[model samples]
Target: AELEIERWKNENAPPNLPELKEHLQTKKTAFVLQEKRLKRLRLLIDSNKFAEARSEISQWKKTGEDLSGLSEMILNLEHIEKSDDIVLDLKRGLAWQKYPDSYIQNLKMAVDRCKSIQSIPRKSFNWRIPSKDELLLFFTSNIESKVQYNSGSYWSSTTDKVWSDYNWIVESKSSSLVRTLKDDYKFVICVTDASSEMIYHYLDTLKF
Candidate 1:
Protein backbone atom coordinates (compact mmCIF):
# COMPACT_ATOMS: atom_id res chain seq x y z
CA ALA A 1 0.00 0.00 0.00
CA GLU A 2 2.79 2.43 0.82
CA LEU A 3 4.58 1.63 -2.42
CA GLU A 4 1.38 2.09 -4.39
CA ILE A 5 0.82 5.52 -2.82
CA GLU A 6 4.41 6.50 -3.61
CA ARG A 7 3.96 5.47 -7.25
CA TRP A 8 0.72 7.44 -7.51
CA LYS A 9 2.33 10.53 -6.02
CA ASN A 10 5.28 10.29 -8.44
CA GLU A 11 3.06 9.84 -11.51
CA ASN A 12 0.46 12.51 -10.70
CA ALA A 13 0.39 16.17 -9.67
CA PRO A 14 -0.53 16.83 -6.00
CA PRO A 15 -2.86 19.89 -6.48
CA ASN A 16 -4.98 18.60 -9.35
CA LEU A 17 -7.01 16.01 -7.39
CA PRO A 18 -7.47 16.81 -3.67
CA GLU A 19 -9.65 13.75 -2.92
CA LEU A 20 -7.18 11.35 -4.53
CA LYS A 21 -4.33 13.01 -2.62
CA GLU A 22 -6.24 12.55 0.67
CA HIS A 23 -6.89 8.88 -0.19
CA LEU A 24 -3.23 8.25 -0.98
CA GLN A 25 -2.12 9.95 2.24
CA THR A 26 -4.61 7.88 4.24
CA LYS A 27 -3.32 4.65 2.71
CA LYS A 28 0.27 5.60 3.51
CA THR A 29 -0.68 6.28 7.14
CA ALA A 30 -2.48 2.93 7.46
CA PHE A 31 0.47 1.10 5.99
CA VAL A 32 2.83 2.69 8.49
CA LEU A 33 0.58 1.63 11.33
CA GLN A 34 0.43 -1.91 10.02
CA GLU A 35 4.20 -1.98 9.59
CA LYS A 36 4.56 -1.14 13.26
CA ARG A 37 2.18 -3.92 14.23
CA LEU A 38 4.01 -6.36 11.99
CA LYS A 39 7.25 -5.45 13.73
CA ARG A 40 5.63 -6.28 17.05
CA LEU A 41 4.39 -9.61 15.71
CA ARG A 42 7.89 -10.53 14.56
CA LEU A 43 9.28 -9.64 17.98
CA LEU A 44 6.70 -11.88 19.59
CA ILE A 45 7.61 -14.79 17.33
CA ASP A 46 11.34 -14.29 17.93
CA SER A 47 10.72 -14.48 21.67
CA ASN A 48 8.78 -17.76 21.30
CA LYS A 49 5.54 -16.08 22.24
CA PHE A 50 3.36 -17.92 19.77
CA ALA A 51 0.13 -17.59 21.78
CA GLU A 52 0.49 -13.83 21.87
CA ALA A 53 1.47 -13.77 18.23
CA ARG A 54 -1.64 -15.74 17.35
CA SER A 55 -3.75 -13.25 19.27
CA GLU A 56 -2.12 -10.38 17.44
CA ILE A 57 -2.88 -11.97 14.09
CA SER A 58 -6.48 -12.58 15.06
CA GLN A 59 -6.95 -9.00 16.14
CA TRP A 60 -5.39 -7.75 12.94
CA LYS A 61 -7.71 -9.95 10.93
CA LYS A 62 -10.70 -8.60 12.83
CA THR A 63 -9.64 -5.13 11.72
CA GLY A 64 -10.04 -6.35 8.09
CA GLU A 65 -6.48 -5.62 6.92
CA ASP A 66 -4.67 -8.23 4.87
CA LEU A 67 -1.48 -9.61 6.42
CA SER A 68 -0.35 -11.21 3.15
CA GLY A 69 2.10 -14.06 3.71
CA LEU A 70 2.14 -13.50 7.45
CA SER A 71 -1.32 -14.94 7.85
CA GLU A 72 -0.32 -18.15 6.12
CA MET A 73 2.80 -18.26 8.25
CA ILE A 74 0.70 -18.18 11.39
CA LEU A 75 -1.66 -20.77 10.03
CA ASN A 76 1.20 -23.22 9.56
CA LEU A 77 2.92 -22.50 12.85
CA GLU A 78 1.75 -25.97 13.96
CA HIS A 79 4.76 -27.36 12.14
CA ILE A 80 6.79 -26.68 15.26
CA GLU A 81 4.70 -29.15 17.27
CA LYS A 82 4.76 -31.97 14.79
CA SER A 83 3.89 -35.61 15.41
CA ASP A 84 7.04 -36.23 17.44
CA ASP A 85 6.49 -33.37 19.87
CA ILE A 86 10.05 -32.17 19.22
CA VAL A 87 11.13 -28.56 19.05
CA LEU A 88 14.09 -27.65 16.90
CA ASP A 89 16.78 -25.13 17.77
CA LEU A 90 18.63 -24.94 14.47
CA LYS A 91 21.02 -22.30 15.75
CA ARG A 92 22.19 -24.60 18.57
CA GLY A 93 22.08 -27.71 16.43
CA LEU A 94 19.77 -29.31 18.96
CA ALA A 95 16.34 -30.90 18.93
CA TRP A 96 14.64 -30.74 22.33
CA GLN A 97 11.88 -33.01 23.51
CA LYS A 98 8.85 -30.86 24.09
CA TYR A 99 7.94 -32.93 27.15
CA PRO A 100 9.82 -35.05 29.66
CA ASP A 101 9.25 -38.70 30.44
CA SER A 102 6.66 -39.46 33.08
CA TYR A 103 8.69 -42.06 35.00
CA ILE A 104 10.80 -39.84 37.24
CA GLN A 105 13.34 -42.13 38.83
CA ASN A 106 16.88 -42.31 40.20
CA LEU A 107 19.58 -40.43 38.33
CA LYS A 108 21.48 -43.67 37.86
CA MET A 109 18.80 -44.94 35.48
CA ALA A 110 18.28 -41.67 33.61
CA VAL A 111 20.75 -42.36 30.86
CA ASP A 112 19.32 -45.76 30.07
CA ARG A 113 15.78 -44.39 30.19
CA CYS A 114 16.64 -41.65 27.73
CA LYS A 115 18.21 -44.18 25.38
CA SER A 116 14.84 -45.77 24.83
CA ILE A 117 13.57 -42.60 23.20
CA GLN A 118 16.40 -42.39 20.71
CA SER A 119 14.15 -43.81 18.01
CA ILE A 120 11.48 -41.19 18.50
CA PRO A 121 11.20 -38.11 16.33
CA ARG A 122 12.62 -40.21 13.49
CA LYS A 123 15.81 -40.72 15.54
CA SER A 124 17.09 -37.66 13.74
CA PHE A 125 18.07 -35.95 16.98
CA ASN A 126 19.73 -39.11 18.40
CA TRP A 127 17.89 -38.44 21.61
CA ARG A 128 19.53 -39.29 24.91
CA ILE A 129 20.23 -37.79 28.30
CA PRO A 130 21.85 -34.38 27.87
CA SER A 131 25.20 -33.48 29.39
CA LYS A 132 25.58 -30.89 32.15
CA ASP A 133 26.66 -28.24 29.65
CA GLU A 134 23.95 -29.44 27.27
CA LEU A 135 21.34 -29.44 30.01
CA LEU A 136 22.47 -25.96 31.01
CA LEU A 137 21.55 -24.89 27.53
CA PHE A 138 17.96 -25.73 28.41
CA PHE A 139 17.92 -23.20 31.27
CA THR A 140 19.11 -20.35 29.07
CA SER A 141 16.85 -21.45 26.23
CA ASN A 142 13.72 -21.93 28.33
CA ILE A 143 12.44 -18.46 27.64
CA GLU A 144 13.21 -18.60 23.94
CA SER A 145 11.76 -22.07 23.32
CA LYS A 146 8.19 -23.25 23.14
CA VAL A 147 9.05 -26.57 24.84
CA GLN A 148 7.89 -26.99 28.42
CA TYR A 149 8.31 -29.89 30.82
CA ASN A 150 6.09 -30.58 33.78
CA SER A 151 8.70 -32.50 35.74
CA GLY A 152 11.58 -30.91 37.62
CA SER A 153 15.12 -31.98 38.65
CA TYR A 154 16.20 -33.38 35.30
CA TRP A 155 19.27 -35.64 35.09
CA SER A 156 22.33 -34.79 33.03
CA SER A 157 25.06 -37.04 31.63
CA THR A 158 27.77 -35.04 33.38
CA THR A 159 28.76 -36.48 36.72
CA ASP A 160 30.26 -34.59 39.62
CA LYS A 161 34.03 -34.45 39.38
CA VAL A 162 34.53 -34.79 43.12
CA TRP A 163 31.92 -37.46 43.73
CA SER A 164 31.82 -40.62 41.69
CA ASP A 165 28.17 -41.35 42.51
CA TYR A 166 26.79 -37.83 42.20
CA ASN A 167 25.57 -36.05 39.08
CA TRP A 168 24.41 -32.53 38.43
CA ILE A 169 20.68 -32.12 37.89
CA VAL A 170 18.65 -29.15 36.73
CA GLU A 171 15.44 -28.10 38.46
CA SER A 172 12.81 -26.93 36.02
CA LYS A 173 10.92 -24.79 38.51
CA SER A 174 13.95 -22.98 39.95
CA SER A 175 16.07 -23.04 36.81
CA SER A 176 19.07 -24.11 38.90
CA LEU A 177 21.50 -27.01 38.78
CA VAL A 178 22.41 -28.96 41.89
CA ARG A 179 24.61 -31.91 42.55
CA THR A 180 22.67 -34.94 43.71
CA LEU A 181 23.45 -38.55 44.54
CA LYS A 182 22.85 -41.08 41.77
CA ASP A 183 20.06 -42.58 43.88
CA ASP A 184 18.10 -39.32 43.88
CA TYR A 185 15.02 -39.43 41.72
CA LYS A 186 14.71 -36.95 38.89
CA PHE A 187 12.99 -36.42 35.54
CA VAL A 188 14.56 -37.06 32.13
CA ILE A 189 14.61 -34.98 28.94
CA CYS A 190 16.24 -36.20 25.74
CA VAL A 191 18.16 -34.03 23.29
CA THR A 192 19.93 -34.57 20.01
CA ASP A 193 21.97 -32.59 17.52
CA ALA A 194 20.23 -31.10 14.49
CA SER A 195 21.56 -31.58 10.97
CA SER A 196 22.27 -28.82 8.47
CA GLU A 197 19.84 -30.33 5.98
CA MET A 198 17.13 -30.44 8.63
CA ILE A 199 17.71 -26.80 9.36
CA TYR A 200 17.46 -25.99 5.69
CA HIS A 201 14.12 -27.75 5.37
CA TYR A 202 12.77 -26.11 8.52
CA LEU A 203 13.70 -22.70 7.20
CA ASP A 204 12.16 -23.55 3.88
CA THR A 205 8.91 -24.46 5.61
CA LEU A 206 8.81 -21.13 7.41
CA LYS A 207 9.83 -19.39 4.19
CA PHE A 208 12.23 -17.29 6.22
Candidate 2:
Protein backbone atom coordinates (compact mmCIF):
# COMPACT_ATOMS: atom_id res chain seq x y z
CA ALA A 1 0.00 0.00 0.00
CA GLU A 2 2.90 2.41 0.74
CA LEU A 3 4.52 1.60 -2.61
CA GLU A 4 1.20 2.35 -4.35
CA ILE A 5 0.92 5.69 -2.52
CA GLU A 6 4.52 6.71 -3.52
CA ARG A 7 3.78 5.84 -7.19
CA TRP A 8 0.68 8.04 -7.18
CA LYS A 9 2.68 11.00 -5.75
CA ASN A 10 5.39 10.67 -8.45
CA GLU A 11 2.83 10.68 -11.25
CA ASN A 12 1.15 13.91 -9.97
CA ALA A 13 4.47 15.74 -9.44
CA PRO A 14 5.79 14.97 -12.96
CA PRO A 15 2.55 16.22 -14.55
CA ASN A 16 2.71 19.50 -12.60
CA LEU A 17 6.42 20.07 -13.40
CA PRO A 18 5.78 20.64 -17.11
CA GLU A 19 3.10 23.23 -16.35
CA LEU A 20 5.50 25.10 -14.03
CA LYS A 21 8.26 25.10 -16.66
CA GLU A 22 5.85 26.38 -19.31
CA HIS A 23 4.68 29.20 -17.06
CA LEU A 24 8.29 30.34 -16.44
CA GLN A 25 8.99 30.23 -20.17
CA THR A 26 5.99 32.42 -20.87
CA LYS A 27 7.21 34.95 -18.30
CA LYS A 28 10.67 35.02 -19.88
CA THR A 29 9.17 35.59 -23.32
CA ALA A 30 7.09 38.48 -22.04
CA PHE A 31 10.11 40.11 -20.45
CA VAL A 32 12.07 39.81 -23.68
CA LEU A 33 9.28 41.39 -25.69
CA GLN A 34 9.10 44.34 -23.31
CA GLU A 35 12.83 44.81 -23.54
CA LYS A 36 12.68 44.81 -27.32
CA ARG A 37 9.91 47.38 -27.33
CA LEU A 38 11.88 49.61 -24.96
CA LYS A 39 14.99 49.42 -27.09
CA ARG A 40 13.03 50.38 -30.18
CA LEU A 41 11.51 53.33 -28.40
CA ARG A 42 14.94 54.53 -27.38
CA LEU A 43 16.20 54.24 -30.91
CA LEU A 44 13.31 56.32 -32.15
CA ILE A 45 13.98 59.00 -29.61
CA ASP A 46 17.65 59.15 -30.51
CA SER A 47 16.67 59.53 -34.12
CA ASN A 48 14.61 62.58 -33.21
CA LYS A 49 11.28 60.90 -33.76
CA PHE A 50 9.78 61.82 -30.44
CA ALA A 51 6.21 62.04 -31.66
CA GLU A 52 6.23 58.51 -32.97
CA ALA A 53 8.03 57.27 -29.88
CA ARG A 54 5.40 58.86 -27.70
CA SER A 55 2.64 57.39 -29.77
CA GLU A 56 4.14 53.96 -29.43
CA ILE A 57 4.38 54.41 -25.70
CA SER A 58 0.74 55.41 -25.56
CA GLN A 59 -0.17 52.28 -27.49
CA TRP A 60 1.78 50.15 -25.06
CA LYS A 61 -0.01 51.78 -22.14
CA LYS A 62 -3.40 51.23 -23.72
CA THR A 63 -2.54 47.57 -24.04
CA GLY A 64 -1.85 47.43 -20.29
CA GLU A 65 1.80 46.62 -20.94
CA ASP A 66 4.37 47.73 -18.39
CA LEU A 67 7.78 48.38 -19.86
CA SER A 68 10.41 47.61 -17.25
CA GLY A 69 12.69 50.54 -17.95
CA LEU A 70 10.69 52.63 -20.40
CA SER A 71 9.76 55.54 -18.16
CA GLU A 72 13.33 56.38 -17.19
CA MET A 73 14.52 55.98 -20.76
CA ILE A 74 11.81 58.33 -22.04
CA LEU A 75 12.63 60.94 -19.47
CA ASN A 76 16.33 60.83 -20.24
CA LEU A 77 15.74 61.03 -23.96
CA GLU A 78 13.42 63.99 -23.59
CA HIS A 79 15.96 65.81 -21.47
CA ILE A 80 18.68 65.30 -24.03
CA GLU A 81 16.46 66.47 -26.83
CA LYS A 82 15.40 69.59 -24.97
CA SER A 83 19.00 70.45 -24.13
CA ASP A 84 20.07 70.01 -27.73
CA ASP A 85 17.21 72.15 -28.92
CA ILE A 86 18.08 74.95 -26.56
CA VAL A 87 21.72 74.96 -27.64
CA LEU A 88 20.72 74.99 -31.26
CA ASP A 89 18.42 77.93 -30.70
CA LEU A 90 21.06 79.84 -28.77
CA LYS A 91 23.65 79.27 -31.47
CA ARG A 92 21.23 80.51 -34.09
CA GLY A 93 20.24 83.58 -32.09
CA LEU A 94 23.75 84.62 -31.00
CA ALA A 95 22.08 86.12 -27.94
CA TRP A 96 25.28 86.15 -25.90
CA GLN A 97 27.43 88.19 -28.25
CA LYS A 98 25.45 91.40 -28.42
CA TYR A 99 23.82 93.06 -25.48
CA PRO A 100 20.31 94.34 -26.04
CA ASP A 101 20.00 98.00 -27.03
CA SER A 102 18.58 98.94 -23.64
CA TYR A 103 21.42 97.23 -21.85
CA ILE A 104 23.98 98.93 -24.06
CA GLN A 105 22.39 102.26 -23.35
CA ASN A 106 22.48 101.55 -19.64
CA LEU A 107 26.15 100.76 -19.87
CA LYS A 108 26.68 104.06 -21.67
CA MET A 109 24.88 105.86 -18.87
CA ALA A 110 27.20 104.26 -16.39
CA VAL A 111 30.18 105.41 -18.41
CA ASP A 112 28.81 108.95 -18.65
CA ARG A 113 28.27 109.02 -14.91
CA CYS A 114 31.92 108.14 -14.44
CA LYS A 115 32.98 110.91 -16.83
CA SER A 116 31.10 113.48 -14.75
CA ILE A 117 33.13 112.64 -11.65
CA GLN A 118 35.98 115.06 -11.01
CA SER A 119 38.30 112.67 -9.22
CA ILE A 120 38.71 110.26 -12.18
CA PRO A 121 41.21 111.04 -14.94
CA ARG A 122 39.92 110.62 -18.48
CA LYS A 123 42.63 109.36 -20.78
CA SER A 124 42.18 109.05 -24.55
CA PHE A 125 42.45 105.35 -25.15
CA ASN A 126 42.28 102.88 -28.06
CA TRP A 127 41.99 99.42 -26.47
CA ARG A 128 41.53 96.18 -28.35
CA ILE A 129 38.35 94.31 -27.49
CA PRO A 130 38.81 90.65 -26.63
CA SER A 131 37.34 88.17 -29.10
CA LYS A 132 34.80 85.51 -28.14
CA ASP A 133 37.40 82.78 -28.56
CA GLU A 134 39.82 84.64 -26.30
CA LEU A 135 37.13 85.16 -23.68
CA LEU A 136 36.26 81.46 -23.71
CA LEU A 137 39.90 80.56 -23.20
CA PHE A 138 40.25 82.92 -20.25
CA PHE A 139 37.03 81.79 -18.59
CA THR A 140 37.91 78.11 -18.94
CA SER A 141 41.46 78.71 -17.74
CA ASN A 142 40.29 80.59 -14.66
CA ILE A 143 37.85 77.86 -13.76
CA GLU A 144 40.58 75.28 -14.25
CA SER A 145 42.96 77.24 -12.02
CA LYS A 146 40.35 77.47 -9.30
CA VAL A 147 39.90 73.73 -9.48
CA GLN A 148 43.66 73.27 -9.22
CA TYR A 149 43.72 75.39 -6.09
CA ASN A 150 41.10 73.10 -4.58
CA SER A 151 38.68 75.94 -4.14
CA GLY A 152 35.13 75.08 -3.26
CA SER A 153 32.55 75.85 -5.96
CA TYR A 154 35.02 77.29 -8.44
CA TRP A 155 32.20 78.78 -10.47
CA SER A 156 30.45 80.57 -7.63
CA SER A 157 33.11 81.55 -5.09
CA THR A 158 35.87 82.66 -7.44
CA THR A 159 35.74 86.34 -8.40
CA ASP A 160 35.01 86.76 -12.07
CA LYS A 161 38.54 87.25 -13.33
CA VAL A 162 37.38 88.44 -16.75
CA TRP A 163 37.17 92.12 -15.89
CA SER A 164 39.55 92.09 -12.93
CA ASP A 165 42.77 92.61 -14.91
CA TYR A 166 41.86 96.00 -16.36
CA ASN A 167 42.91 99.17 -14.63
CA TRP A 168 39.47 99.60 -13.16
CA ILE A 169 40.58 103.10 -12.25
CA VAL A 170 37.39 104.81 -11.19
CA GLU A 171 36.78 106.56 -14.49
CA SER A 172 34.24 108.77 -12.80
CA LYS A 173 32.48 109.20 -9.49
CA SER A 174 29.32 111.15 -8.85
CA SER A 175 27.96 111.92 -5.35
CA SER A 176 27.56 108.21 -4.63
CA LEU A 177 28.17 106.39 -7.93
CA VAL A 178 31.39 105.28 -9.59
CA ARG A 179 31.91 103.71 -13.00
CA THR A 180 34.81 101.83 -14.54
CA LEU A 181 36.60 103.40 -17.55
CA LYS A 182 35.75 100.57 -19.94
CA ASP A 183 32.01 101.08 -19.49
CA ASP A 184 31.83 103.17 -22.66
CA TYR A 185 32.28 100.15 -24.88
CA LYS A 186 28.93 98.77 -26.02
CA PHE A 187 29.99 95.22 -25.34
CA VAL A 188 33.20 94.59 -23.48
CA ILE A 189 34.43 91.20 -24.39
CA CYS A 190 34.46 88.87 -21.40
CA VAL A 191 33.51 85.32 -20.65
CA THR A 192 30.27 85.65 -18.72
CA ASP A 193 28.90 82.90 -16.56
CA ALA A 194 25.15 82.91 -17.00
CA SER A 195 24.56 80.90 -13.84
CA SER A 196 27.21 82.46 -11.63
CA GLU A 197 26.66 86.14 -12.63
CA MET A 198 30.42 86.31 -12.79
CA ILE A 199 32.40 87.65 -15.69
CA TYR A 200 36.10 87.55 -16.40
CA HIS A 201 36.46 91.18 -17.43
CA TYR A 202 39.32 92.73 -19.40
CA LEU A 203 40.52 89.45 -20.81
CA ASP A 204 42.27 91.58 -23.43
CA THR A 205 44.79 92.48 -20.75
CA LEU A 206 46.35 89.05 -21.21
CA LYS A 207 49.43 89.03 -23.49
CA PHE A 208 47.96 86.26 -25.65
Best by TM-score: 1
Worst 10 residues of 2 by lDDT: 195-204
After superposition, candidate 2 runs with Cα above 4 Å error: 1-15, 61-85, 88-208
The best candidate by lDDT is 1
Residues 1-208 of candidate 1: C-alpha lDDT, one tens digit per residue: 4565467676864564568767878777876876777678667766656567767867763444344444444433433434457777767767777766777888657777666773443323455788987777777775225776765678888889999899888887666889999998888888766534443343344411
RMSD of each: 12.1, 19.4
User: In model 2, how large is the Cα lDDT of residue 165?
Assistant: 27
User: For model 2, what is the alpha-carbon lDDT of residue 168?
Assistant: 25
Q: Looking at model 1, which ten-residue stretch has the lowest summed lDDT?
A: 199-208
lDDT per residue for candidate 2 within 1-208, as digits (tens), equals 3354456565755566556666767777776876776667656755767667767766663344343234333433343345422111122211121221123322335334334432211121111222334333333432323211211111111122466522221111111112233323332321212210010122112121
